[model samples]
Target: MKVQYFAETDTLYIEFQDLKIVETKDLDENTALDLDANGRVCAITVEHASERTDVHRLTVEGIAA
Candidate 1:
């Protein structure tokens, strides 16, 4: 998993898989989910991140096989 934040747009993106997203579905004006061609979630996008979400401090813990 990887997390990226764009200070300019104040948007946060979290990628769950390495697959490239083919489509995006907005949950709301400020949040959206990304899916791969197989319809599996590949990533997430959040707009107005500064106000919509906490952009500071992220922790990841897991093992991928």
Candidate 2:
């Protein structure tokens, strides 16, 4: 999994898998979901992320070593 933030576009992208995105579905005007061929969610994209999310703070838990 990976999380990326683009300061120039104020976009936040969270990728749960490295699968090829077959389709993109809009959850709203500023949010979108990326799905693989199997209809599994591959990633999520958020526009105007600065206003919608707290990009300054991030925490990860339950990661297996």
Candidate 3:
């Protein structure tokens, strides 16, 4: 898993897996979900990250695996 924030685009991308994205779905006007061919989530993308989220500060809790 990985989380990346691009200052230039003001976008935040969270990748769940390193898989090929088969389709992209808009969760809202400023958010998008990426899915693999198997319909599993690949990543999440947020636009205007500064306005919607605190990209400057990030905290990760309990591990999934």
Residue-by-residue lDDT tens digits, candidate 2, 1-65? 99999999999999999999999999999999999999999999999999999986999999988
Ranking by TM-score: 2, 3, 1
- Compare candidates 1 and 2 on lDDT and give the better one: 2
C-alpha lDDT of residue 65 in model 2: 83
At residue 34, candidate 1 shows an lDDT of: 93
Candidate 3 regions with alpha-carbon error over 4 angstroms:
none
Score candidate 2 by TM-score against the native: 0.96
> Tens-digit lDDT track for model 3 on 11-61?
999999999999999999999999999999999999999999889999899
For every model shown, what is its TM-score relative to the native structure? Answer: 0.82, 0.96, 0.91
Q: List, residue by residue over 1-65, the lDDT tens digit for candidate 1.
A: 88999999898999989997899998988899999999999989998888877688776667667
lDDT (CA) per prediction: 0.88, 0.97, 0.97
Sum up the clashes in candidate 3: 0
Top model number, TM-score:
2
Candidate 1 deviant stretches above 4 angstroms: 63-65
Superposed model 2: Cα runs more than 4 Å off: none
Give per-model CA RMSD.
Answer: 1.7, 0.6, 1.3
